[model samples]
Target chain A: MPAPIEFYFDFSSPYGYLAAQEVEGVGRRQGREVVWKPFLLGAVFKTTGSAPLLDIPMKGDYAKRDMDRSARRIGVPFQLPTPFPFSAVAPARAFYWLADQNTMAAKDLAMALFHAAFGQGHDISAPDAVAKTAAMHGHDPAAVRAAHDDPAVKQRLKDEVQAAQDKGVFGSPFLLVDGEPFWGHDRLGDAEAWAKTGGW
Target chain B: MPAPIEFYFDFSSPYGYLAAQEVEGVGRRQGREVVWKPFLLGAVFKTTGSAPLLDIPMKGDYAKRDMDRSARRIGVPFQLPTPFPFSAVAPARAFYWLADQNTMAAKDLAMALFHAAFGQGHDISAPDAVAKTAAMHGHDPAAVRAAHDDPAVKQRLKDEVQAAQDKGVFGSPFLLVDGEPFWGHDRLGDAEAWAKTGGW
Candidate 1:
């Protein structure tokens, strides 16, 4: 057994969705409790001087292809949602609210939202969609929504994103095991291995 | 048919080797030529402030895994070279010199070197090994050796690396099709598509 693994994410990122789906089983197998830390990706990127694919067309187009290839390789179904680069504020706040209830539940709903946004091509910003996805994971959608609007919860999400920046994390789906940051979904294996061997 | 593609490369990168192995076939199918440009990775990194792995340890380790997984998914034979990062200066310079004799020859030898370095785990810097590999591609071993040591040829390679940086290439295995730069081996398909549409 090892210390818990915390995953930082934004509901808008497809890679974060993949991590949410894939890293759960990996964490359980390696005796680590996978904690979801949903945060604002836009804030982190702004401060870190990073931009989405829309800013760099060459890298962005390639990323979409790589994500398609990666999902297929990993055996996950994928469908890119329209209205890409969707606003993540509402969904991100909902995630923080749910995480305060049960960390694992927050993770499951996050994946469902990802599947909706990037996999099913649904808009997660729509309150109905976010509520429906949360309900699927056994949470009272209205209660989750209420908590989402709480000033403290909203600030908590903002603080987590800020904390991520302090920890040298500049991207979504960052996994920190015993405080060592792993910045991509692809690195989940390393996160697991480190948990298993207690390696850095 | 589309115009020829300008393929930029750094021999130290495993992906460049992978692309070199397959780009010609892609070019031939589309009735386009590949203009191979061998450049120094060190120079590109120096100008762009791009460090390997973006300062995330877990992400860096997982990247190696993802690369291996990508290689396997592509059905390319690969063996991790010992002394993980080998000296690439000699082979990169040789590639530049060989371009003077035959661009196609340079491309072929570069693939062979990649297969040798990453596929077979051979030391690409060794004179005997380089000569042996060059001979397999029908290049005169003695001439290859002589070209490697030519002072003028070495200077030309530095110039090419600088030129690549000036062109906003901050990464290895950059592909320019229809004047659009596709960075990274992961973007090969996009480059191929552009070649098909006479884009680059």
Candidate 2:
């Protein structure tokens, strides 16, 4: 069997949330596994000189509508958070912490967090909210809270961001199917096709 | 009948070249007329704090491949110009000049210019190159050259850019179907659906 596809995202990104709903299904249909990897988009942005989608002037309003339209088209529930572009550090750290122990559980936690932020329109930048989501997902809230602050977990998130940049991932919802980089939810279709056909 | 979809683009953009090849067909399939309007993207960039896509650090390389991949997917011919991001002033000026006299001939001229730049990979940044492409399309090269020197034509392009920015166009291949803005060549699908359903 071929290697699993790498799905990279930042928890703060709505497009990433949208992609989270689809990448796994696309990979499964192709008989390949999708490894979810969350990274710091801010770190990539520092090098790329790009700001958050909502921070850009005129494009912000259009992006807002596009995200909504795209979610509706894709049949996923979505609602923008009151304070968007929130910090993904809590979720990123938690994901890596859990991933080291149970990768599947970590993925469930990531999905729950995304649903909380985009589906429920909750503020997830705080560790407490992340812990709450973990509890809802059948994980211990206290353990998650502690893990969110663990130095090793914190360092794991940092190292992953550096590794992602080294791997040429400059945007959220980035994916590497057989090592070909596909950025954004828009390119998810391209990545799926590449995985199916093994590139053009 | 609904109003024609306004398609805005800049001459130097590869994505715009891709859109130019597909947008008219998409509009026609939906029984909607497409009005091609060439604008100076640099003007929009100034206000939105965006530089050229190729000027961004890591995204430049990715964008180059993305353009090629997108063109291939759309079955449109594409070749990066020899010193890309060349001055599109000549073509933009000529387009406005001819648009005043004959809209259909102006569109043909735009398509020919796009073909010269991306399809044939020619350096179409100069008045002479623009004239050459115009002459190839059965337009008078001498007359186009004179049109290039016309102040009214130059101002017409500038005014159009200003008007496009006012309509929240931050990038090339921007489209408005029934006054809803959709940006990028990636959005042609959404625009088609919007036109067909009169928007969801």
Candidate 3:
């Protein structure tokens, strides 16, 4: 009805995983639509000159602990994915491909993929893994797999990431409320307040 | 009493300014002593291979917006100071100097400096500014000025920053609650909960 809250996240970001589990509720509470827009942090990082939070020196170790503790604090399941900071091309492309046909199903598949990667600490970096996760949401595995390699699906994902970078979406769990960009899972509350109060 | 909650911050950090306003209240609410430790972010950044949050590319523009928005969302005054990311040596050294004489006075003065920097959007890089802030907190201006360059006071601040790095603190508004390191003002709520529940 009003402006939809555009949630931008990367598949490999633990903070994005944590926010994915909660942003919908926040949107529902504020009477706004939550649009899940997954983009490649790898591409965004190239523009920002930053790396994965876990790739830094001492901060890398602290991030591991924070991810676990933050998940627990928020009452969500989280296990750090292995070979993390994975590329979002597979899952993101699959999401857009499915979203073209079914937006609801696309969201469901996104939950499944996030859950697989962060909930159980499994690797969803492969197209097969993303397709498998999609199947659980009633999508055909074969179609899902095909979307990953389809040129249009690939471009859709590319265009989305390009749009995000052009708009300065530099980190995971970023939200855009009426074109106001809120970065990091940390700002979820602030985003919620912005949605609720109309402005601050 | 158990261990006091350790607050590590750099004087020039916007998030640190926000946290400085609330950490004491959180500590009081949780029935713990809140220890204020000001360190040089420049030194910590050198060790962590990180630069100021605003120095990065796309993220830099977003950070400026986030700082102001977050400060309002949380109901605190904030404005980006001129020539932002100022050196913390003068303010931090003055803090440590006053701390050596009076811990309470040091905290009061710390608040004054933070208010001067963020609340009024003033430059606090000069020794005179810090001395003036301390004087407002009931300390003598001349004494505060002399402490900024005192060999012992300078070394004290340096040693504190070194110790913080050894303990893996790499950001401002970082709180170590019962040895659990929480980075960012965004994690302040998590830190408070950790202090209250003995950690989740």
Candidate 4:
């Protein structure tokens, strides 16, 4: 077994959803435990001076093609639920809401929300859509909505986003094991190998 | 048959050399011409607020791995050049010197410089080394060196670097076939295809 692996995810990114689907299985194969850390990507972009993929003319197409190649190579289901970038504010807040109730429930909610937003083309930013998604995963819809609006819950999500920035995280599906940050889904194999060797 | 493709290159980049060796072959098969454009990468970085691969921790390693993979896939002979990130001043100036004489000489000089830097691990920044490499490729060493230091040649090289910035180039090995800029060696194939189809 290896040190704990922390996965930081943003519901708005298709790559984050893809990473969520296979991270657990890969970690299990390498005898590593995993935890989910859902954070706001907007905060990350503001702090890092990062540009959206669509803004970088050639990079977006290349990245999509590369991701498809990677998904096929890894034998995973890959789909872009929406053609446009979905606002992730509500979805991100819902994650923190789940965390306050139970850790395991929070993990499940994060995966469910990712599937809804990036796997099924839903507008995850809508409070109603987010509440509905949480309900599908067995949480009370009203309770989840109320929890999402809590000032403390929203601030906790903000804090996690700030933490990701401080840790030098610049992109989605950032995985950290034993304090070493691995950015991008392509680094997943390296992350697994590092985890296996128990390298910090 | 297709229109000539502009091959933007910088001697300091290993990938540019790798692409140079094969781009002509690709052009030959499609009955197209390759226009060699040697510009300073440092100038591009300054205009775009970008850094070299070595400056981006995880990305640098990814570049090395990708280059190795690309070499095997393309059957190109590749070795990590010594004294990497060489000063591009001399080489860029040397290339402009050759270009002033004739286009063919510019093409040959570009290949020779790439091979000298990445293939033979030579210090391309040194005047003597560049002269020797040019001589080995049948160009007159003394003439090439003299042309390199000419005030007009120096100014021309500086102007081309500035022009590349004006054209929105921010990275090395940028291919602008038919007025469209393809920013990486990986996009060489696309540039070639675009040339073949007369697509900008």
Q: Highest DockQ: which candidate?
A: 3
Best by TM-score: 2
lDDT of 1 at A38: 73
For model 1, how does the per-residue alpha-carbon lDDT over A1-200 read when each residue is reduced to its tens digit? Answer: 56678888777788887887777797779877777777777766655455575445334555776577567656788777877788887788887787777766766777778877877888888766688788887878887777767899779877877777677566778888887666676667667776776662
Q: Write the per-residue lDDT of candidate 3 for residues A52-79, one digit (tens) a residue.
A: 7878888899988988888888888888
- Each candidate's lDDT (Cα)? 0.74, 0.90, 0.87, 0.73
What does candidate 2's lDDT look like per residue over A1-200, in tens digits? 98999999999999999999999889888999999999989878888889888878888888999999999989988998878778999999989988989989999999999999999899999999999999988889999999988888888989999999999999989999999899989888889999999887
Docking class of 2: medium
Which residue window of length 10 is worst by lDDT in model 2 chain B? Answer: B39-48
Better of 3 and 4 by lDDT: 3
Task: Please state the CAPRI-style docking class of candidate 3.
Answer: high
* Candidate 4 lDDT tens digits, A1-200: 55778998777777787788889987788777788877767765664455676545445554565455445545665666554566777887887777777877888888777766655556677888889988888888998889778888878878888887777666788888788677776567667767776642
TM-score of each: 0.61, 0.97, 0.96, 0.63
Q: List the residue pairs that clash in candidate 3.
A: none
Q: Per-prediction TM-score of chain B?
A: 0.89, 0.97, 0.96, 0.90
How many clashing residue pairs are found in candidate 3? 0
Ranked by TM-score, the better of candidates 1 and 4 is: 4
